[model samples]
Target: MSDKIGAAEDPLPLRWLDHVATAMNVTGSSLILALMVLIGLDVAGRNLLGAPLPGVPEMVSLSIVAIVFLQSPQTLRAGRMPRSTALLDMLTKRSPRLAAAIEDVWDMIGIGVLATVAWATWPRLVRDWERGTFIGAIGDFTAPTWPVKATIVAGSVVLVLQFLARIWRRHRIPDGKAQ
Candidate 1:
């Protein structure tokens, strides 16, 4: 028990990444709560006061993307990302090593996909930040677009790291136990 606890307590980079991903997940949950509150208020105002909340539409649109990005890293880390696991499950019963290898390759592909997304997003993030780009009308409820862009980029990078960590962990364990 002590050994297991100590092993878990070790300050490894992958553990640090897990901590970061969990923190981001919590932030995403908080954002979701905030959005719910905002939406509820908007509905109440619209029904009772005959006036809806300003910028609610824009905020929802932007926040939807940010929330997905914010929560994705932890989702992947937790093995909760949606996928067809039927083949892997069948293969794992026959050959754990082969299944582990396939899983690692999948993680590699995930890293590549996320890296490409981050690469594409970086220039846009910079452009938005530099130009002070916003999503709302002038002299009204306006929010900077760069924050959402930055969140996307950051989330992609962290997800890539999580993928790498998964591969690393797979290799560290014996083949039969990898599943």
Candidate 2:
């Protein structure tokens, strides 16, 4: 709903994908809030009770990566992805078609990069799942790494899909749908 581009302009499938991305973004934001609370509690515990949360540091490390991946697609779809727009801005004034073409190319490159990241993460995810890989001490708090790896792969795929959607949106035919 925070998207700069209106949802009405998106095709049904793209709209569905946007919904998915928005849910993921919400989940990421919730995770951030949880982390903040956990850190605050840990600090309070340390200062007041002289007992800190055991897995706070490890949880924070894992959550940071999860947060970034979880929220990326929505960030891009909202037109909040950080980039210099000097060239595109100038190009748009001169030729809108050329600007769209250049944006499509840029999106294509984004697809490649995210796809590559997902492809590379797939094996690690499998390995972690199969081996039950975990972080933290043996007798203390421990968390499976597979979930985080899975998040990375899933997020990357969604991000690639978002990039493809961007390209498709740019190249839609006169019928108001992608070819």
Candidate 3:
């Protein structure tokens, strides 16, 4: 584990999480591209032949949802989520220790919120699966939504773990240096 951590500036677990996030983002991008191409082809076929593509809207909608959920973890890992840094920056300038403590507390609260939301929504996801909900023009195009919901929950879990890792690394660092 130490060797793995030493191989990268980040801890091993965090690095692995980052890798997963990156992969997911790439996959999501690919899906988006495919969706665009599909839509373009469908439009061209309809305009040229006067025959509309069946279930194109439905497929695109599902693909968009998947892309959003799948890319969430990568966004979080990149620290791109919006946050209020006014108070944090002020505290950091005044007292480094207090700033660190506040940061840890903020991370904890974020983790708790994300975990609780994921936990609460999990049952609904299962119920949706059990009920066999389908979204499309025809019922035959049924694709289970549970997998996308599960991806969201999994992304939150990964974010929580990443925050915890950040807290741990912060403790390892001295007063004014990187860990």
Candidate 4:
């Protein structure tokens, strides 16, 4: 492991962002634990008796997306995103500035993509919220769909902000220490 445990490189702007992302991560983690408990109960119910949790599968399906999006911005912030960097790696030794520029370009693209998604999803979220749309058996075990859609919008906005923060942080890094 790298032996650098000092405060974040750009701590001020990111402090709030970090806290928000951490909160999102905690929320996602709690959901995961809840899912496990739910699945365990479901399995026990199925095996011990003939009845099982209604809409467990549906709940899981919805939660999977929520979990992924919830955790993604934090993952991106951590520099843990799984990206193929063969070209960037090669460029780093030969042309560090170029590599940094390319990385910035990628961040710009990411910002645009994320912004577009947030834009697109907002209307759907509003419609769902306004209409009180839901999923699963209507009267059996329905869950409000807006919350998940809102999560999507929130996650997308966080990612966009994170990408912007990354770009800002990148520029703040000294010329010789750009990484």
Candidate 5:
């Protein structure tokens, strides 16, 4: 039997996770594009028609939060998150084993802190939803604030999980060689 399986033979859980991540990425990209287009139109309308788009700021803020949360896991998966590599590079050159150990420790601490913050913020998000807090803006454009808040909590949790995965994968490789 071959080690590789056909598409039909793939596990549902893995497929589902892939689908979810793909959907999140696409949705986040669409939201970002829409936000950009909307802002452009808003600015044009303001300059041309002398009237700004009502609640543009509120919409932009919410869209930005959604984009960040939805895109975070995808970014983490792609290893695109910003990092200061000067220290890590120096340490790795000196001692790869020590650098790996330090990285694992750092990831563990990050996971713990992010998980704790997510846990703490979840209830507050729920409470905000229950209270039906609205964005303060002129006119009747009321945006629900809980969803944005919850996104922050969810994104942090996902980032923590991603870091954990990275740490586990790093530990699995002998000699810390690039795969």
Candidate 6:
């Protein structure tokens, strides 16, 4: 009796969730591309002109975490996260519903884990924001740490939302097939 869970005709909330996920995913992707450009520029400046840009290390480290977290929600929602799916895939053929149920359980577990992480990081974010703590040297142009922490929280929250949305989706393994 089950039907497609997140059909195009779904209510507003699911659509809103999709919109936010897509936006965050796009931002994450853009950040990755920008990082590539920045690294290239830094290398060029360093090797060609012998003028290495300062604070790149700090930027790269912080951006990497933000990028992963940003894309995590969409990746998980689309069932694209790397994992051993052979067993569940085989089960899908035999019992799609059961496979889906098991998948749902995993999704719920992910939600719990990510949500806990976000909750735990909350205080750190507050401290960074209040203290205005930063990375890089005093004369090397320091970057604020709060943005990175906030991004991590944002990403975690987005991932949690995606996990819950996966439960609402009520699909099978999807295996690159579910929309």
Model 3: lDDT of residue 177 = 69
Best by lDDT: 2
TM-score of each: 0.91, 0.92, 0.76, 0.90, 0.78, 0.89
Worst 10 residues of 2 by lDDT: 1-10
Looking at model 1, residue 126 earns an lDDT score of 96
- Give the C-alpha miss distance for residue 31 in model 3, angstroms: 2.0
Candidate order by lDDT, highest to lowest? Answer: 2, 1, 4, 6, 3, 5
Regions of model 4 farther than 4 Å from truth: 1-6, 9-11, 173-179
Candidate 4, 1-179: lDDT as tens digits: 11111145557757788788889999999999999999999999999997899989988988998998899888888887789989988998898779878988998999999899889999999999999998888678998889888999999999898888777766664546644
Residue 155: error of model 4 in Å?
0.4
Query: Candidate 6: what lDDT?
Result: 0.83
Clashing pairs in 1: none
The deviation in Å at residue 15 for candidate 2 is: 1.1
Q: What's each prediction's clash count?
A: 0, 0, 0, 0, 0, 0
Give the alpha carbon lDDT tens digit for every residue of 48-74 in model 2: 999998899999999999999999999
**Model 5: per-residue Cα lDDT over 1-179, one tens digit each:** 11111133335643444455557778889988888998999999999999887888999878787788788766765566677868877988898878888778877887898788788889879989999987865475778889888877877767676676666556543455553
**What are the lDDT figures for the candidates, one per model?**
0.85, 0.87, 0.72, 0.83, 0.72, 0.83
lDDT of candidate model 3 versus the reference: 0.72
RMSD of 6: 4.6
lDDT of 5: 0.72
List residue ranges in candidate 6 displaced over 4 A.
1-6, 171-179
In model 2, state the lDDT of residue 119: 97
Candidate 6 or 3, higher TM-score? 6
Worst 10 residues of 6 by lDDT: 1-10
Q: What is candidate 3's lDDT per residue for 1-179, written digit by digit as tens?
A: 11112125665777787787788889889988998888998999899998767778877876776787678766665666678878877887898789888878877998899799789878878887898776654644556667777767776777677677657766765456663
